[model samples]
Structures are given as C-alpha cells and as structure tokens.
Target: MAMGRAHVSTDRPVAGRFRPVEITHRETNRVRWYADDLRTGRPFLVTRIGLPPDAGDAVRRAPSRVLRTAGIVSRLCPERTATVVETAVEGGFLWIVTAWIDGTPLDDVLAGEGAFDPVRAARTGLDLLDVLDAAHAGGLTHGELSPGEVFLRPGGPLVVAGYGLTGTTPAPRLTAPSYAAPEQARGEPAGPAADLWALGAILYALCEGRAPFRDRGRFEATLRGVDRLPLRAPVRAGPLTPVVQGLLCKEARERPTGAAVREALARVVREDTGVAPTAGPDTRPRGGHSPALLCAGREVSRRAVVLGAVPAAAGVAALVLAATRGLSGTATGTSSGPPPASASGPTGSGPPDSGRDEPEPGGRGAAPAPTGPPGSAGLPPGYRTLHAPEGFSVALPAGWQRLDTSGVSGLAYRVTFGADDDPRRLAVTYSERVGTDAVAVWRDDVEPLLRRSGGYRRIGGIRATTYRGREAADMEWFTAADGTRVRTFGRGFLLGGGRGFSLRWTTPADGWAEPGSREALRTFLRTFRP
Candidate 1:
C-alpha cells in the first residue's frame, strides 16, 4: 500500500464531483487518487498538486492553460499520453483528472522489478523519443517528466502524464528536484533542452534503479546538487551508457536533439536485441505511374500550411495521416466541362459535370476560358491546367501557384498552391500508406485530432461516398484564423493496395456558400487526375 501526504475522508469529495477511494501514488507535492466520477459513475485517476501560497496570477490562469495544453498534446500524440478529462484549481490545490489508465507506473515497475536490461531500457527510450519529437515539432515541452509520470501498459506503448504542470509554480523545481536540469536549477526557463535532460535522467533511473541525483532531505539542496555536481557514471547501463551520458550533460547547448537521441536509442536496441529496428509505415509508391508529376493546388502539406499559420492545426493533419496506412487506388479522371451551378454534395462517382452555360449561384457567370495553353480547353473560364512532375495534374484558377511541397523520399508527398493575399487554398496529398476504410479513417482517426483545433466544429457528420468510382469519404469542418472563421472540405479515397489521395479545400466560412467558392471546389474535383 502507498502512503499519501493528504488524507481523504470517505464522505468528503475533493471537488464535489470525484469521490476518492484510495491513494494510488504520492510524491513530494503531488498525490494520485483512484476515484469515481459522481456524475458518470466511471473510474478516473485524480492528481492533486500543491500550489504556492502566493501563486498570484498563476493560480487564476493555470487551470485553463493546463487544460488547453493537455488537450493539444493529447490529440497530437494520443498513444503517448493519457487523456486529460478535467482540471480545476481550488483551495491552493491544482486538481487534474484523467481517464483511468490500466497500467503500472514506471516508478512502481522500477521498485518491484529492479533495473531493466539494456535492450528494454533502449526500447523505452525510443518510445519516449518519438513522443518528444511530436511535442517539440508542435512547439511544446514536457518539462516535468520523471519516473512517476510514465505508465507502462501491459503490452502497449508508454503513456505520459503531468504535461501541463510545468511553469505553473514560482520555484524552478516544484515537485521533482532531482530531475531538474542544470539550467532549471539555476532559475532559468525550461526549454526543449530541459526535456532532453529529463529523458536522460529517466534512462539513468531505468538502468541504475535510482535517480541520477538522489533526493536530499530538502528540495533546495537537491536542486543545488543538480546544478553543480557532475553526473555519476552508470555502472549497469551497458549499451545505454553513451546516450545516458550525452543526455545528462550539464551544458544545455551540448545536448543532442530528439532526432539524434532516437537514432542512438534505435542503434542500441538493434545491437542488443539482435533484431533490426522496426520500420514505420511505408509511404512509397507500391505500383503507380513512375516519376510522379506535380499537381496544381494551394498551400503546402498540412504541416507547412496549418503549422505556418496556426500551430495547433498541424495536429489535425498529423492525426489524419497517422491514422491511415497507404493511399487508396481510386484514381481521378481528366474529365472537363462547365462547373456546377452549385457545389454538389458527396457523390459516388467522379464529379458531376454540366455542359450548359448557366449562371453560377450568387448571380455570377463563369469567367471566359483562358486562351493561354492547349491543355486548358476543358478547364473552366479563368482556369489553366498544370501537369506536375510527380505524374499528377489538375486545373487551377489563374494566379494560383505552387506554394510548397514536402514528403519522404519516393514514398509520400504533398503539394500546395495559392496566390498572394488569397484567403482560400487547396492541398493535394498523396500517400502510399493508408488504411482500408475511407470513412473510418475520417471518423475514428481524424476527427479526434480535429476536435482540438480552436473553434473547431464539424459542418456535418462524415459522409461515406465514392470518388472516381472508388470508396471515399467527405468531411467538412469550420475553424477560426485571425478572427476569421474558415471552412475546409476534405475528400479522401482509396486507390487500392495501400495507396490513396486526399484533396483538402479551404476558404473563408462567410463566403462558403458563394458562387466562386462553389465553382472552385467543383472544378478541382472534376479536373484532378491521379
């Protein structure tokens, strides 16, 4: 049985909602409770951290900041972190409630199992490195990582907690003084480098069966030792000694990056386990037109487009891509005709085309066809055709140009296009890695991530349909940018055998129903040829 600093009487509820059952774990200023939600009658893990008596504004703002950060990180790396259910600050206590995780805390595992072998430690290090890579790419740092914050599922990956607790207290080392980096102990701001140091500390604890810097009787004393004393050599680290030493360096500038750490840990795992490192999902073309051509579109890949503008939006893109395996075999066609008067709803086949010279919705007639090039014959007025070097082509409105392109070598790539001062953009993403069900990819895999976006609300439920005579799904949602509400329509379809393509069109929500926006969407759907 574990002992806690704070006792919970059975009759008294902590926040008038959670009924504490037992103390699961406890640290210097933190306690974990196995509690039940009075409203839902579901079990949850509630953690309470003591705040300083004179926390000032931190007391008022920490609740929202912590919740928001937890939400963003949970969506970005769902498998790597626990889902935060709620947070509150009352009576000098910051209460964080998360979904009950059925796993053993790393601290408990260390206590019961003693030191882990080098291969096991290296494997755990790789998992931590991947999570850190995602968080840092999104500009977040898990500054308070320690053995107690990590939980290992029976056979699943590690899940981290205590993400939003950093920077909430005045003291540099609020709870875990021994884990603080040298810079943090010196009263400096914690950054990505600090996370690296903490990772090293965790690695050390796993192999050595104790923290690099043992906790002194006082917090200040331990932090001082961390700031001044050199790291003791690891006696049982085996292959992990080099990485542990590299990460525990006192000089923050000399620490290796997350990528470097991943490489080193992977090498160690391979050398010790006698098995090659597992490869991630393959995004390479299985069997398509060789030398894929560039396609006309707007914005860059989801990362460059949304991350460049709104950092959190990258979470949405990453979630969608990571959920699926390869691109579908549903290839688009080179059909051409007059644009639809209004945007058609989700359809089962290629985009509907009309030959009539009818006026578009919102009282605007289609612009006259541009007389610039030969392939432009079938394009709508003011639109021209672009054939990319990647073996794909599409028609784009005049003034649209390729903004950016990104992907792994020969596996997957995304091309974006738009013009200066344009509020609307289109992104074409091709992947050799996608799942089987187009609808499930959108609903189960992508929507959870999108929910984290600010002002994110789906226009309607995800609709299953067909594109270019192949299985597809359409999802529409609204988000805010610079105080302007923006809308996006995504069409993802399978091309068979783990190959797929997705077309995302975004525009100002206020103009979503206008003639021009409708025409642009219809034209792209009709002209795109994969």
Candidate 2:
C-alpha cells in the first residue's frame, strides 16, 4: 500500500487518460501534479494519495465516495471549494482530478514570503473559516485540511481542495499527518471540530512559519506527536493568539464552534488596517485560465475579498464593537479614563458619513489651509496639547475639554471635545479594524447609517485624499440636533495594520466659515498622532 511515501509512474496516463507533467506540491502521503487530459487537451491538477493495505472494500468504493463527498462540499461552498473533475483508484492509490486552480498553494506562499504578519494571517484564517462554516453547516467535514490544500488567489477568495478523500481509506488521515486533530490521531471519528482544529493549525503555520506539530519522517510517528505533543506557544499570533489557542484545545468539545471562530477572525480582520493584499509567486500553469475578478456581482478589492453573504448586522456590530472598545493600544484618551468606542456620535466625532449634502463653502468641500506647525507647536493664541492616556496626542482649543468617552474596550474608541455649552466641537476616533477604502467606509458603510439619523444632509461626494502621506478620505455634512443645525467636516485616514483615525469638526452651520472655526479643523488634523 505505498505507505512510506507516495510514488507514481510517469510512463503512462492514469486511468489511461490523464498524464502527469510536473510535480506541483507534496505532503506526507500525498503528491499534486500538473497534468493534461489526453482526450480534452486541458490542464488539471491531479492529486495522488496512499491507501492502507487493509483498506479492503473502501478501496473498491473510493472513487464513488470521493466523488460524492466532493460534490456535496462543492455545492455547499461553491467557488470557495475546488471543482473535482474525476476520481479513480488503481495500484493501491487513489487519484483525484480537479480543475487547475489559478493560484499558489498556501504552503508555497509561505515558502516564498516567509512568515506572514498576524493581520494577513488573520485575513486568510477568516477566509478558511468561511468554507469550513458552510461545510459544517451542511453536515460535511473536510477530513484533510492543510496549507497544501488551500489555494490563495491574488485578489479573490481562496479556493480549497481535498474535500472527499478523508473517508476513502480506513486510516485516520490520508495525508498531512501534522495537521491531523487529536481525535484523528487516536483513530477516532473526525467531525466539524476536527476541521476547526486543522483550521487553527493552518493559522498557526501561517503566522509562525511552521506546522504546530512537526511532521516526523513516518506518518504513524507524526500522528503520535500530534496526539501527545504539547503545543508551542505562538509568539507571533498577536491578537489572534487567543483564537489559535482556543481552537487547538485538546478536547474537541472545548474548542470554539465555527461561528465563534468566524466572529473572532472577522473582528481581527476589521481591527488590523495594516494588512496589505496577500502576495505570492506566480504559480498559474502555462496557458491556464485567470481567476475571475468579479465575485457575486462586485469587483474584488485588492485588500481582501469580503464574503457578501455575511450578515449586515454582524458587520455593523463588528464596527460598533470595535469603536466601542476604542483604540486602546493606538488610541488617545482623557487622563481620567480611556475612551470607549461606538457609531452614534456627530460627524468626525465618530465614523464619517458619506453621500450628498448641501453645497460646501468651497463649493467642493475643500479643506482650508493649516494654521500652525503640527502638534502643540506654533499654536494660534489659546490652543494647548491634549495628551491622552490611550497613547495619542492632539492640539485642542483652550476651552475644549473631553466632552464624551465611549468605546468597547479594545476594538476601538471615540472621544469628543467641546466647551460645556458651545456650538463648536471636535471629535477624535481611533479604530483598530478599518477598511482599506477610506472612501467606501464613508460612502457605503457610514453614510447609509447616517441617512437614517435626524435631518442628515451630506455636503458633497466622499472625496479621496491623502493625509500626512497615508490614504484618507474627507466628508462634510449638516445635521440637526435638538433643533440646532450643525455643520461638521470629517477627515479619516488609514495608518495600516487595520488601524485608523478620524477627526470631526462641528459648529453652527452658519458660523462654519469663521476664521477660528477653520483653524480648529486644520489644527486637529495636523497635530493628531496615534
């Protein structure tokens, strides 16, 4: 049963049709090859996996079992899972043929790029959890999930392979023993929890640059290590440390459910604004097809592919929770206490709103010129630096004191500043999770919600701009609060690593053009530092 290492003959086509042309990737007991369909002259990825000698009737039914499982999973996950073209069993080996994936394997990406930053890894983990969530919900399990089975497209959702081969043999796991869950290592039935464990292992590998359990030379030995070894603490997982630890819990019952994992991963994705788009070597086969740029009617953003199916409420909650927690690490707060987070404050005091509003003073909402050097320096008359305990500092008018503090504790926070009864106010918001598109955050996410608030009128189109060399956007609007018309100018900027800040300056709509009011907007933007 080719147990030691999988071997394939290059002499002839497998099933008398598919011919292996090049070795693509290899795991403990599996090998992936770039192959050609002799009859169709089309390129494909064919995977060969070893089977136990005593597999008995399972070997006879392997082809059908693989096909059935693959079909079930493909329907559950759609483009997120690989498309299985055919399955076959010959010479004590099971062969799986799938359409050529137009991307690099996850392992190959790690090899080429070394250990990924925690933010990028969390983004990938979120994508993987999406497929797992769908499969588990449909009562299916991905028996063998490892970096080798995951394919990452440049600007699209990742595609996973090796769906149906897990139960085709009596052996607990067919390949990548290091990724096997403890139950699988003990020769017990694997369930959705097992897939979650593997998902954690993959996340660990992506951040640490190695599998949680090292693969011993022999498959049996590797499984033994997985079953008995103590896990090495993940030093680089950062905020994802808890998630990796929760999923790797020895008892399957103790591991977090797929939904819980999704929530945590999504939170991480939202909080880390520094994650650049995932990049890797060009692994697309010669004459191979390019990956589809459009996913579910929207063009994929270069940062990450957000699942369209995720509940809107859940997304809003993530933002709210983040803002409620505020930017503890990267945020500045009053000395009395740190700022808490949320989404309900006036413009620039919380999240910026997008869409049409009254025409701006400049006719296009252009920001006025700076009045002083950045920080507390060269202040015009009575301005002073308000140093916040949360780690950011900004210049504020003499009468301005922290008006409100709201946040969720860690996700994000917003602090408003104003005189007790004054019509002018300044709001500073720090968020750990923010979209790369500053314009979209305002127009798409923030604006829709603003429209529902009382008498909200936008000034102009959300304008894309740069602040201190970082990607940023600006929006202005008017809103009636307690029968008073207030004009607010908001500017939000990204600081990478899923972290960002927004400054909102508000005053009586009729008094927005006063020299003092104009200076406050410029001073806040120039002096603020997270």
The candidate that achieves the highest TM-score relative to the unseen native structure: 2
Flag regions of model 2 displaced more than 4 Å. 1-7, 274-530
Off by over 4 Å in 1: 1-11, 279-530
Query: What is the C-alpha local distance difference test score of each model?
Result: 0.61, 0.64
Task: State candidate 1's TM-score.
Answer: 0.52
Put down candidate 2 lDDT per residue, 264-377, tens digits, no spaces.
776676676544333221212331322221112122322335221111101111111112122322221111111111111232222211121321253212121211234433
Taking all chains together, the TM-score of candidate 2 against the true structure is 0.54
Best candidate according to lDDT: 2
> How many residue pairs clash in model 1?
34
